[model samples]
Target chain A: MSTKDMSERPTTVLQSLNAAMHRLMAGDSRVVVLGEDILDPYGGAFKVTRGLSTQFPDRVLTTPISEGAIVGLANGLALRGMRPIAEIMFGDFVTLAADQLINHAAKFRWMYNEQVRVPLVVRTPMGGRRGYGPTHSQSLEKHILGVPGLWVAAPHALGDPGSLLEQSVALEDPVVFVESKVCYGRFLTRPAELRAEEIRTARSPFPTLHLTHRGGSPDGVIFCYGGMAPVALEAVERLRDVDGIRVDLVVVAQLSPTPTDHLEALLQRGISEVIAYAEEASSSAGWGAELVATIEEIRASIAPRRSIRHLRIGGAHTPIASSKEMELHDLPSAELVAERLLECF
Target chain B: MKTGERIPLCNRDSSPNELYGLMFGIRTFEQSLLDLFQRGVLAGTTHTCLGQEATAVGVFSALNLELDCAFSNHRGHGHFLAYCGEAELLYLEVMGKPGGVCGGRGGSQHLQHRNLYSNGIQGGIVPVATGIALAEKLKGSGAVSVVFLGDGTLGEGAVYESFNIAALWQLPTLFVIENNGFAQSTPCALEVAGSIRARPEAFGIPTTEIRTTNVETIRNETSRCVDAMRDGAGPRALVLHNYRLGPHSKGDDNRDPAEIRAAWDQEPLKVLRERLDTTEVQLMEAAQTERIGRARERALAAPRYEY
Candidate 1:
């Protein structure tokens, strides 16, 4: 019984989130939805929460335009034996709730010596595409990576966001669920003519879809997630078609408490060079930097015999400008990934 | 008390004697901490609710202990002790012992026990209390949530946001602003604009002002407001106009000595003592002092929490 023959249809990222909320609330009465403008008729800013408040009138709460209060409110609800899904509207606004999210929610369990479990999911759209300027258009999940005791889940383009979101809600710890703004309307992709088993395996929870070219060991491996997955795939195709560089791809679904073991296993599969890319604003402590550190640690400890070279592709350190040119300059494109892949090889 | 009737200054269920006991316990505990800090026994300094005992004690007296939750600010020792009545845990937590409520991870400013929570940040718990009330409302538990904030917290934007949402949703929440006349060194008059009630009242929430340190009056007003909330009357604000007789924190007494001394006359202990017989006052004071002394010894002797 090959998994490829399962006949599962593709779904948009928005549909995945909506379906996840419906299923979560339907199955568990404890799950609640709260955010600004999330009530029916208004939905949310990106309409990800459309029809949710209407379906679950009493459970879904429409909060005021207060990110700090909204997050703190969710923390309170979670502490009081309720599973709360709080939406921050935009990822950039998470800065406003940093104190509650980082100091209170993240440390509550540890500080309280496990007297409480903060089972809350904060869903917000991250990454740039709508020219939302510096504040609105940001992959702010990078800032949340270093926070202790907080889990971060970012569903990739090929992965099932609904399944991941459900997992996040059921988790016993606080989670920051990041949905890519650009990926919301895009359809999940599968290589044409692939077996149903291959597609099913690729969509499995935390599965690393390694797409190799030339039917053998790839020249390099690229790691990415969310909106960057599609761009990375396009880069893979271009590298193989034009530059004759056969590269492999390892798209991650969970970023924080990163799937380091899976990444180490992928690296151990004999690709001598790897490239870690992120759409977040570049810094010394960016996600790409963490990935590089993990790669180096894994290489040093586990696979020292076959030392691999690593290159990181992250956003520009400067704030994203509203203009198209500067926006383009700020974020990494598939062409840039392709060029970087070729140069690294 | 009838549905629309106001709670009298002293009622059968108000338990003025027990409330007085709790107030005395809070004061004794705080005074012991001050002594401990001076002797270098307690590591970090604490913000004592010296002059604000009646505000916390009165409000806590009105709460349904089985259902209600409270969120307190930096001056939370009084609230935590008044609500939970666990003087030993508070002392142990301050001493960073394993037997403490939070296992010594959360010191004075971050004490949490059962339904009571407190943090050092101003206005941070306002929304958290609203959320707890919202949860209770959804669960059909008829429970009310209370938050104790200072006049200093009025400057935070989250406080107003919490009021707006709590009022809009009709959450069973009560916001008690301990207008201690000063936000640290800055006087409330200089920091706050207009009135403390104006902000919550703007959101259509009912407001009550209690200008005295009379625990009986505070208990009556809070009981009325809490009852209204239990009857689905949304959020209410109580401005307990009191003064901070002590400095904000240890060794930070920036307030005028004359003003501090003047505010001492309004101490709740003094007010309660005046109403009681001389023998009754002496008995209550002696009992509370012995209770705190024993709690301090136990807390000090408690084994340290190994991290």
Candidate 2:
């Protein structure tokens, strides 16, 4: 809303995130980065933590390959007056630290009569691109968002990186930072002239703006976030070819408390059917459940012209395997994403 | 029941063995509970840490209160007392009263404090302590975590898992195995198959098996190993081979007194008493009077926990 000072605009999510992370590190001494191979020995498996160790050697620590240990240690550090930014090698490995993350970090303050505080951030990659299926590819943010004491920050665009990320790190509670593996290498436009769209090989998860159809208005809306945003955009493109229907994209940057205000206002503008979050993992507790819950609360207030649908694709209540074939079998592709988007009609 | 003979830690001190004095701390602590139980004052059943105090006190005494965090077992009053002393919140818990720790929702087994934490599950505190130590090591806090488990817990793989992780991370943790020889009447020989201290040593951890009953000797060994760990040397274990002074819990009311008398024959506390021939007569009387007074005060205060 305050774009009067938009002297330089970002065109990619990772670029915006990079600028935001750089700003945060320079601003706070309590903020630090950690995880396996996050240091110069190897600038992290995804480069999300690249160069942080060199810039803040005392703060950026490279831990052993133990997701549970990473989360547990972060919980401890957070309680001990440090805002630790921990990383799991992959989203799949986060299951290993469920005991600490779900049970301790999430419940510490509430369990201890509000005596403990877990001011920490977890940065990990989910979703597949390079054939790292079930085991390596998962957008399991829902698994953690349900836990208490944690606020989920999943920016879908490069814009507002400073506001979204800096506020997340500065919030008094724990924050979950989810990065999609499929989007890590992507680039973006910072300014029309001074854009630095570098090939992101390091393990750094940056931010970029997603201008699917710059400055376009639509009669209908689709609310979504995380790795599925791009897929949803592709599906929207395909859907437009068939009916030329005006489709609005509401790319959410946060997931914990659904943004009902934005969606409601869009729906009020005569949108017939609005599709919400969907992905692999399980239709039970993830976005599917959240969609139904949010819609149920506001359905009575919506006009007769508005409707909501879930573009879900999930599996049984077990961890997905890392096989490419199985992963593809698990998550619905861009074609299916298009099909589901049309189903709202 | 003190015969009033005190032995000094040194030849020149001319006082009671400081080690036995600390055991008396736990012994007196338990005796107070027993008296309260008989007087129908302390409510609910308790798993006394009578015979196991030396191991806990020895190690806990070496801990730096400001930096160290401890995970306690179901039987952890000594731990609570050693760390923060007279945890009134815990008393509220046992009394099944509103003001108790856990708001009385968790009785004796669920004792927990931030500086000192615990859970009701057996060998449960092992992993919890491992996690705490992992936190300390990760934060570079120079703080150490210690968990005291019975030999019975050796059979639980959770302890082994915790040991593997603690040792793997070189976490500053002290694993104290109070081998009082039994797990609720099931002897350790009947349960644990391999060596106990070997569990840590196999992981290249520096373990000390000080099979001593003397509180002072236990303290010396615990302090040495805890010192090494606190200095970030790595996780260490101490196997205090001693005798269980009382039945497992008040539920063991049917326990044969003969069984206790039989175990008392090799009593580590008794062994300690015999080593104090040079104890001064005045200090001996004073130690006895102190023990009795402490026990009486606890008994008269009425069990802070009321059913």
Candidate 3:
């Protein structure tokens, strides 16, 4: 099948990811899956690795509860010419493997003077909504975003997450694939009237998904990604319906290396007058901050005289509460996002 | 005599002259590094395997370089020398010159040559080595992966995690613990509790404990272990009890002078010298000195690694 048809085929975030792994393992013997309880009868905590072990029992490794070892082992495997995808059951547990990821896997390529490539991927379920409490629910991709030689990718439901994951696994450097926990069951569909364009950068292989209205010019632009992409899209629709405000929503898949060139080009084209950066993670020193900084720098360089109103929409600066009401309060809601986007106007 | 009491004479594939030459080469190369550091010719720090040359030489002698791979730790000059005998490249690397093993990016701690890899972080390479073993096993490549660590690394949680996975998965891995009786001057008594062998043994990996600086003994035992691993005996652990003759890095030694002197009596070179022909040892010494001197001159003449 052609790449276009395969991507056009309908798939949920979970199904897309599972099918990608299945396709990768079937086509390439070098690709292997390693994680805790990722085998048959238990397809991992999120079922993203379902049927992998059964189909390729020898290649699929159901590891012990050791996140650090899992990533470290993946690094070794990648070093030895095997493409390994290590799954951290919960994104919060990624902290356990931070040393290996940050120090070893990330630095191997450069530290070894490009003699070796660590084609390893660490995929995990992140974000808060299911009331799994403080530990299980977190958008912690921000912590690993700026690490040199490590690629951080968080594909949204609207884009081809499976293709992004495949691209990530095929890269020579190590990548952290951040899968939003709440978005697993979400279908990868977009409004018929909305137009989607992918913007690629020289530094990164993952493309940024640019979503806009079919004909009407947007009053403002909102940048969001991962689980927050759906929320941002909802906010855009609500703004148009209630306040007659048109907003363009950009779903970024690659979070690291900042995609400065593509973002600079977007700003230069003047996509919208009022711009807002939104994310499910906390606003402090996060994706929102980095994007805002990039936008500000670009705006300052190109159009210093013109004024562009900007605002950052993000989760509350506190631990995500377990209660449904409190969790809703802490997280960014469509109404809250729309209300905040109004401030930019 | 105790395991580490004296160097043992054994009939092995490598002659005594070859073993002594390798050990002497490592010792001189390390001493040159110290000399270069004192003269400000070398920058940054280096962890030399001054007192632990026997383990590197012994374990590497048994390894099939074509099939087996090794992961080394911070103190890895000995292992690097024993595995490939690339003194010129190592010199270029330590000197931060071009054409080094890792293009001078890894410096002294991080090095890669063929199937041998070294890292500065303690206990981090254990899992990496285990992973390599897993890859070899999956590939059906009758190979064994070996990782060298200090007693200090036992404190790291990752080492035990690697042990658990290696044992659980039945990977053909050899975990060699070079217990030099100190964790950068803290001593093993203050850091390690219970027995080191019991740590891996608890994970169902059969453990072998050796307390000697004898390269022949280490080579023979490691050959047995590697042979078994290649034959699918699963993961094995070897606890080699030796002593550190030099400072952990540069002039950081805080141990008593008397104790250092005591360890010198059992140093691998001194012990092995007694078992070899005096004339041959002298010739090997002259040859190593000239070889290393030329490597140093060539490395010094090489250009610095450009960005």
| Fnat values, candidates in order | 0.68, 0.10, 0.79
Clashes of 1: 3
Candidate 1 local lDDT, A1-345, one digit each (tens): 011211278678888888888999999999999999998798888988898888889898887789999998898899899999999999999999988888788888887767888999999988886798988898878888867888788886577778889988988789899899888987766555222121222222345556555456667777787888888878877887799777777677667776676666666666465564645456457777888888888888876676666777878887888998889877888888898777776
Residue range B1-307, candidate 1, lDDT tens digits:
0011111122327565666777777878888888899999999879998888898788877788767899888889988877767778888888888777887888898877788888777877788888899889989999999998888999998898899999899999999988888888899879998978787899999999888999988888999998999899899999889888777888797777888888888788788877777877678678878877877887888788565
Give the C-alpha miss distance for residue A3 in model 1, angstroms. Answer: 16
Better of 1 and 2 by TM-score: 1
**Model 3 C-alpha lDDT per residue in residues A1-345, reported as the tens digit of each score:** 011222456678899999999999998999989999998888899999999998999999998899999999998899999999999999999999998999899998898888788999999989998998788888898999899999899977888888989999989889999999999987778765567788996675688878787676779999998999888988988898789888988888889978888897777667467888888888888998898888888888998877777788889989888998899889998899999988766
What lDDT tens digits, residue by residue, belong to model 3 across residues B1-307?
0011111122247897889888888898899999999999999999888888899889988888777899999999988888877888888889887678888889999998778899998988999999999999989999899999899999999999999999998999999998998899799999999999999999999999998899888998999999899889999999999998999999898899999999999999899999999999999889888887888887788788556
How far residue B267's Cα lies from its native spot in candidate 2, in Å, is: 5.3
Q: Model 2: how far is B141 from its true place, Å? A: 6.7
Candidate 3 vs. true structure, TM-score:
0.96
Q: Which of the numbered candidates is closest to the native, going by highest lDDT? A: 3
DockQ of 2: 0.18
Per-residue lDDT of model 2, residues B224-243, tens digit only = 88778877788998887877
